[model samples]
Target: MDELSDADLERYARHVILDEIGEEGQIALLEAKVCVVGAGGLGSPVLLYLAAAGVGTIGLVDFDRVDRTNLQRQIAHTDAAAGTPKAESAAARARAINPAIRIEPHDVKLTPETVERVLTPYDLVVDGTDNFTIRLLLNDACYLMKKPLVSASVVRFEGQLSTYRAFEEGPCYRCLFDAEPTEGLVPRCDTAGILGPVAGVMGTLQATEVLKQITGLGSGMVGKLMLFDALDYSMQIIRTRKNPDCPLCGATPAITRVGG
Candidate 1:
């Protein structure tokens, strides 16, 4: 285990002063490994906060490249970074925020093969991907690997956050949304247009859950889903339970592997 240097102590003074996140929590953060599945709007803030909190190792996965349209909410990528891989650009921004972090970038789409290989190394997984295919794949992968999965989604003015740790008796993502939404029914940020700050809110919540999980300082979102409606500025918590018939985590156990 690496000890905090004098510079680190000064930098995280406020964090160290907090009762919930003192020196011990900071050290736990420094030793924790987290994997983020996308580098778009949600992934942007999640990566930024986790890096600032001194997470020792962070894995970034995104196949998309920075585009002019992404500047609206994807704060990590700048105009100059246009055409650069999103994962690489995100890593660069994260490094700029805190040089002590070690960022691993995978400039490739999350597929069955890559999900297992990339996610297996991390202690926790954060889902910031837009598509359902990748989301389901991640849910299954995290379940099989017994890794904590902190997930968040934002669209238009609404957002949702949840934590899934199948091994710990909490419900997995599949228990809530058994399958993907019908195609063309749910619009992507590129298609429907998302409010910038709304993404930041949900993403930051995801990072909070991740930090809480790592330090065991606060109650995690596990077994419940938090919903945010930006327009109304209201929040609701819905209790969730693991589906005994869930194909992935259920007794029948259809899913055996990360991508199976």
Candidate 2:
């Protein structure tokens, strides 16, 4: 465990003052490692807060480059960084916020061969991507890796978030979402158009869940799904259960291993 330096004490004084997250929790944040799989809207707040909270090492993975259109919600990237890789851009902002911690930029595509390697080093995984293939891939990979996955997605006026740790007999993502949505069945955020802060709301909550996962503080959201309707300003927590017949974490499992 890393001890808090005089500077760390001063820097995180607000956090250190909290009875729940005193010096011990500050150290836990400083010693923790997290990987955020997207650098888009949701990933923006997740990465930035984790950095500001002093997560020891933050890894960002994205193959896309920043675009001017992304400026509306991808808050991590600046206009000058429009053409740079999203992961690198996001990492730059995180490092700027807290140079005390390490930020790794994985500017690579997610392949079956690379998913495990990409996720292996981190203590937790945050999914902010909208692609169904990558989402399912991450769900399966995280379960196989026995790592906790904090995932969030925003589309139009609503978004949802969840934390999964199936290896501990908790509900895996697959338990609730057994199959990927059929292609074209669900519209992309680009076409469907998201309300900007909806991403921020969910991502901020995701970051909170990440902190909770690390420090063992507050209610852990392992077996619950949070749904927020930005249009009506309503929020609900729905209980989740592990499925006995789900392919991934079921009694008779079909996905014994991850990847092809």
Candidate 3:
């Protein structure tokens, strides 16, 4: 592991002072690689904080280009980047935050075939994607790769966060939602509208979970879901358990590959 640079020491002064995340923990963060599966609302703060915290390598996957409406929540992209690709915009911001960090931008959607190929190299995966299809795919890919996944979702004023390490015996995302919700059941941000700061709160929490896992500071939400109600400013914690019949991690498994 490389020692902290003087600049890093000063930039992360507060983190370095904390016994939970001293120079040693910071070094561990410098050697860690994390993949973020979106560059939109939930991804904005997650990418920013993780990069500032000195995660050694970050992979950003997104194929969308920036739009005028994205400014409300996608903090990484600016007016100048309104027409730029989301991943490129996010990667630029991440690089600006911490040049020492290596950011690999995948300017494409993560299909089942490409999921494992993109995710296998990372130490951990952060699911900031909005749709259930991408979320389930990421969960299954992480399970197959035996990697830890920090998943978070935000819609309107409410959001959910969970961490899954199925390879370590915790429940996969499939255990939480047996099957994908029916179409139109949950409105997306574009259709339902979202409070920008609400996404910030959830994304920041997701980044916190990632850092906690990286530094081993506190116990992660490995088998629990954190529900945040921005309107009431209340948080609820629900415990989760592995399902023996879970198609992905069960005794009689069906999912054998990234998309299977």
Kindly give the number of clashing pairs for every candidate. 0, 0, 0
Q: For model 3, which pairs clash?
A: none
- Give lDDT per model, in order: 0.91, 0.91, 0.91
Across 1-260, the per-residue lDDT of candidate 2 in tens digits comes to 65789999988999999999999999999888899999999999999999999999999999999999878989999999999899998998999999999999999888788999999999889998989889888999998888899999899999999899988957888788767788888877788888888889999999999999999998888899999999899999999999999888889988877773
Model 3 misplaced stretches (Cα beyond 4 Å): none
lDDT of 1 by residue, 1-260 (tens): 56678987988888889998888888999899999989999999999999998998999999998998878999888999999899999999999999988999988878898888888789999999889888999999899899999999999999999999988778899988886789999878888989999999999999999999999976889999999999999999999999999999888988888777
- Summing lDDT over every window of 10 consecutive residues in candidate 3, give the lowest-scoring window: 1-10
Residue 22 alpha-carbon offset, candidate 1, angstroms:
1.2
Q: What is the lDDT of residue 170 in candidate 3?
A: 73
* RMSD for each of the candidates: 1.1, 1.0, 1.1
Assess every candidate by TM-score. Answer: 0.97, 0.98, 0.97
Q: State in Å the error of residue 60, model 2.
A: 0.4
| Lowest lDDT block of 10, candidate 1 | 1-10
On residues 102-199, what C-alpha lDDT tens digit does candidate 3 reach at each position?
Answer: 99999987898788788878989999988889888988888888899999998889999999998986799998887878999978998899999999
